[model samples]
Target: MRDEYYGRLLVQRYQLLEIAGKGSMGQVYQAKDTLLGGVIVAVNFLSRSKMNQRVRDRFMREATISALLGEKSIHIVKVRDYGVDEEEMPFYVMEYLKGDSLKEAMQNQPMPLPKFFSFMRQICLGLQCAHDGIEIDGNVTQVVHRDIKPSNIIIIKDATLGELVKVLDFGIALLKSDESPTGFMGTPAYCSPEQMDGKALDNRADIYSLGIMMFQMLTAELPLKPKTSSFDGWFQSHHYQKPKLFSEVRAKLDLPQALMDIVNRCMAKTAEQRPNSVTEVLKVLEQIEQNSAPLTTQSQSYTANTPPTVEAICLQSIWPKDKPRAEIVFPQLIQYRETEIATMWIMLSRSDIEKYRNNKPHSQFLFVGSPHPMLLWLTTLYQDEQQHRMLPCYLDLKKPIGEKILQILNQTGSYRLILFALEGDERCVCTIEGKVPTRKMQLLKEWLLESQNTGANHGQIKESKRSLKEELDTLKPKLVASLQRQISKKH
Candidate 1:
């Protein structure tokens, strides 16, 4: 088996060095891309004997989808090239990633809370991007990674983000809009109740699998144990048995009740009981992080009656003054500062800052990235119990506005909403930020697709702008209500 592909060249480009691994999809080889100065890469080929159309279609789709997703999110493994061999076998070259599989890292031990939070968030971000769906033909089809388990996640070292996690193997990912028949596909130990029943699956099914991974990550044990390792045994376990409580696993397991609740909700027998989207789950995660913030020296100094000054709130002491103030960038925590918490920094004149503090400000976040790569990041920070301060910055990918948003985000870590603000002026009285759980980016993507499909001859650009205006009109009230709710909640 090893000798078969030992020194073989694929597509007259990739020189196979050795067999790396093998799966149901095909064999993966550690190879060198001859066209790229002999750079190391992983080349995966379809099973040689069985060149059936079904397997070929699935393999090609996996490669295409993985490549498309990798372009959008850093967490998904990137596919570089695809080709067919002389024997009509399909193969794809991917970036060779060297890391320990999450399963290997688990090693029957619970992951530390901090690491678990960081890694799980990265995993969810990847899943969320997939579930957000990709444009296929004229439709946006949600990709359900039917197989989500510890083994499919790779953790590698990074200079900025530390342990960078990448989700691997999209061979069995299901496009919900695809009418093709797919058999029961998932690791039995981590399959959702719906998946085991051969029912049509959705993001919830992946969420279910994610729950099992979460349980294992926290406790190093499966929540529901099958009587045997067989399919039927696991089916019975997933369908009939309840997930074991944290206390049931270990008497003194130090874990947050909130974290436990999230895991349990994900593993719920019915998908309806689970969190509807990853954003919902992320909201809870934000709460957890905020709750876990240790009281810092600065925090101890400030009282509820006396708020921190604009200088302190803006992190002026350690702010990146070299970077342009109007430019949008990734949100960076004040890690070196005494107060280690998530905050947005902005520079404003003393008078403007004072005026902003006096009045309640609104905020809004707008993103249009399909037809154009642009993001209108905005925010309003509660200055006190009675008022708010507005911050806004627009980012265009084509210009300097977008430079650091994605690059810095990738270097640092997972998906985080970077809040930005403009220098106060007479016209800066109003601002807005998204508060609704709705997927704004998804809607924009679909509208962009529709506009593009309209073609230039049909006034495509104008049509898109009009439709977008209509959508914004409808969305504004919901967003305003969301902002008001935030204000009320604080009061």
Candidate 2:
């Protein structure tokens, strides 16, 4: 059967070129659509005689769903034609994509932040279209792509969008009225808790899968570690255990706090806790992109005012001497783009510095800082309760008085070591590294206070805090510029 289809044209129209891929359900062939100006298309054929009634039904449904969903979204792979051959085997033709699957790309390394966000937004849009329902026979029927994972996501180059995201493989998709007696399907690692439990699923399940994918793209690792390769192992992990926090796992990686929160919510154990629909997820992502645009721009043009030094920010004497029990935590490098001057520096607001002094655990801060305008804009966007927390720290390029603040940062694991200098009125906010900056800093300060109370001189501890406070106070107003510009002359 393979040989017969490989050489001969199906229905005397599609000229079979070569086998593109083969799967458990069917085979896909690279074919020339003679009837369509000889355009290259992918023809997926399901050998009817070789399959049971169930498999055949699933295959036909796949073709129909692909066709329906494709019409609703450009992100979904487009289906052009569907028919049965003279031999009674079913085949469907789709627009041939000339790119690798997301699975293949991740094998090299995780995608950069800009590319990852862009691809994810498109994926959500495609899924939202499906979730919104498709019109058929004057009735709308909702569809859920039960299988959403890296392998099912294809990256194609488009003339306009650049990197286009195409979601494939709707073979296991569930229709609103579908009553198929299918058991559990979908990759275990990426499956939601509801999906694993064989409970009725919805758009939220797909949201869970997306969260898992986002975690992988950001850190190249899964949130939940499976104990065994069996389905039960994964099921137990997804249902019973709490996945490690993204910040906890990738402590050194600088990521936006809001973005991580969204990802975490998407993977919630219960569907009720997850985003109500793909639309909600899309809205949140869009807001993040809009709010982060200014800071992203600043990071791209980040430059330090001093000489570029290869030396890691020194942490040895930065901490207070009396704070013997306090441990220093230094920021780890996420990505470095070299320029004449450093392009990024960590910035902290007055409130943020105060939080560190107070040392509250479980307080997660974004590595990227929010520009003043962005902060003001975000406040108006979210509720009053959420306004303050949504603001991010930006990089301050002004020179530090000495190594004292550097020591405090190292001990608290609060800031990255990017040097920055304010040349003019340009105000910049940047991301800092650390899981619990406030707690760490508080511990260090506590240790310092204790030492002074015992035998150490109280004058030094008070002077250090006073000096740091003065420096921060002096820099606060200057960092409020709405516009950030690169200095014309290099320092």
Candidate 3:
């Protein structure tokens, strides 16, 4: 049946253009809707030879679910028509999307933070609409998209939203009132614990899958890594294993603590522990976006006897005269690999700080420092709300601070502030009010250079390696408890 229908007209309305894609279930064709001004559309046809009763039923169900969902949500692919051809094989038409699948987009690297968030928010919106229940014959029936993985999510270019998200494939979606077969149905990597157990499910199952998608988008990796290739092993891991913390997996990425917390909740082992609804997830995402600051780059130069600028003003509020004040300047521009750090620093500067001796507080400061993992970790932990009350400054720790910088630091009053410093083999967190000694500055530069050399080669390797056996062992107790609960329910 391969390419048998090419260049043929279906119902004298749709002209098969070319083979768009092929899956285990059916072959999709890029077609032109002759009746509708020749608009491009996708037509999926079930193979006549392979079309058994069960296959036909599933194909129709997919069409029905997609049609119902498309009417309610823009994020869903719109179904334009459904019918059978002259051979009596069933087919459905959908709006053709000119974009790549999420799986394709993430094949090479993880998406940028802003783009990732935008895509996620749209996905949640579509899921929420589906979970809200579709109306049929005056009754509302809940729809659970059992299969929500990257491959099923399409990213299209939109005039307004730039990158628009469209969720695809509802072949296995379950209607709450429908008495369908309760079998394990979903991609193993994205399946929720309950879904893996073949237990009753709801929209929360989809949320779990979405969580896995988020994890992958952020790190270009899955949270759960099954030791064996067997389906049973993967199922058990999803059911019993605890997902690795995002912070631990991508420590240098500088993700917001709040966003990570939301993802964590979404992937909770128990459905009850996850957000009650997709709407709730959307709300959290909105809050994070609203509070997040934009990342920007600025280049400035300072000379001796220059008047105190905003950076100097903010430094006065952060450093106290009674304590040793120090500024570390790196000779080269230290690249902050994580976009979250730049946003965090921006938010920190906007926060309010008590003025010293009637002097105005500064909101911006040059960051000069070595790229230490500890510093990155600490910065990531700084929440959005805390940004309003603290003055944060950025400095390059690799370069020597000139006399003008020392004058500005010494001018500030005594205050408790955080100075991320590295001493010999240890990373130290200290609060100082007086000027830093020249000798100490020299030592920090040497440490920064040495750390950079070693980190360039070993940083990623160290972070990526984990003991799979230990991870599986920790999940043993949880697996036992879950099995016991299932047994008790049967009794």
Candidate 4:
């Protein structure tokens, strides 16, 4: 896709320098955010044509994942903003670094042992970020970077230091414990066997890729080179073949025993046999780093011993002979707006009644909303009501707004009634049906009329719910008409 301009009327940050790189869904450009006053930034833009549901989900999800990773030691590209231009093209702003691929770094000059180990340590830090980001909804979703080849590993050149590693390509990575994941996603060469088979995968898949990368970084050669050109054939080799030892690439590059031993554990065929986690990998790497001693030619024997901790629980999925699932299978819930809200209210009603039956009356709920009187009303109601509870929802969900409201209600069913105050024309009352209590409805109608000083309060009986209202004075007859039709239809 061709390059574009600002998202809104206001001039944005980062002046466009030129296109730096492009992934399947977006183009990464070297830009200067003019508003930020010429600080360099990487601008990733996804053309509208490329934005199918999956691509859009992946694009936005990048920002969500990045926000969780604010570590200075981690090699993650920081996300500045994700938005659309007037033409509706999706773009994300990111921190830019001048660097070549690790493949280039490896090829350019033999890295000093200290620098080499440092790069490896940095990679683990970035992976750890993905494996443990607190989500937009206040839930932690473990990120697994399934692709970890040299190409995706950028070596940022600094004026002072030689290079710093920044691990990229989190867009296609899986978030753990998600329900009903769509399908397998990642580069084939670097993909874990489970990832290749469309089986469920978790953090271990990333460890496997890290293993392959470590192998390349140390030995300077891939464990397996498929004779056939097809990617499927190349992937099949991972399942069938024993990886060539780092010794095979020793001619090209020599790594110390401590580092070599750690790389061996990462290249294990089975995910369980691999380093149990990025954390474990870091431990081994530290061992390599702290050891100022040396290893001889015979000391190069690398054993497969990954320590077991809570991380072993994640690796347990690999024990069975069969390949595992490629991603999570979350609980399925229906996807309607008002119907979802009603379902939530129904659950809340049941829970509150249960609470009343059991005799516990006091509770507090922190209602969150952007500052508005309506939000203030909801929070005040939360505090004022006793023996029954009502609170506005704060959690961010993957679903739409109305659907999320229902989810919160369903999840926290003890609410006597969750209050929602509408702003502008996005009305929910007309859409809700027989599930609404008439008492609440009447109270709400009067409340609306008093707030606006009009509508059904005039008392006429002729109608149906409307999407738009030119005047509140016009609603009473419509309300009466709607109720009569409902009663007559029921009879």
Which candidate number maximizes lDDT?
1
Whole-model lDDT values for every prediction = 0.68, 0.60, 0.61, 0.53
For residues 367-393, write the lDDT of model 4, one tens digit per residue: 212111010112111111233333222
lDDT of 1 at 122: 76
**What would the TM-scores of all predictions be?**
0.65, 0.59, 0.59, 0.56
Worst 10 residues of 1 by lDDT: 425-434
lDDT of 1 by residue, 1-491 (tens): 46677888777788998888875598899998786567788998898775799889989999999988886676788888898988778999888888899999998998887678778777887888899998888888899998999999999774324567889999999999867537688899999988998888889999899999999999989999889999999999999998998999976787878888998999999999999987677666645644554433323334434444323333222334344555343343332221223333455554545555444444454645444444454555554434444455444433211433423332332222222335532122221222322354444345334433432222133443454455566775566567678867878
For candidate 2, the clash count comes to 20
By TM-score rank, best first, the candidates go 1, 3, 2, 4
Clashes of each: 11, 20, 31, 25
Clashes of 3: 31
Candidate 3 per-residue C-alpha lDDT over 1-491 given as tens digits, one digit per residue, 9 for 90 to 100: 34677889999999998888854368889998777557788998887777899889978888887888886666888887899998898999988888999999887566788678778877887898799988878899999998899899999875323466888888778888877547888888899989988888999999999899888998888889888857888887888888888767777888888888988899999999999998888877755754563311221223333332333222222222222223331111111111000111111111121212122222211212222211110111111222212232232221111221222233331122323322211112222222233554454444444533432212222232233224434654554454345545756
In angstroms, the error of model 3 at 216 is 0.6
Q: For candidate 3, what is the TM-score?
A: 0.59
| Top-scoring candidate (TM-score) | 1
Worst lDDT run of 10 residues, candidate 4, spans: 372-381
RMSD of each: 12.7, 22.2, 24.7, 20.2
Write the number of the candidate with greater lDDT, choosing between 3 and 4: 3
- Per-residue lDDT of 439 in model 2: 61
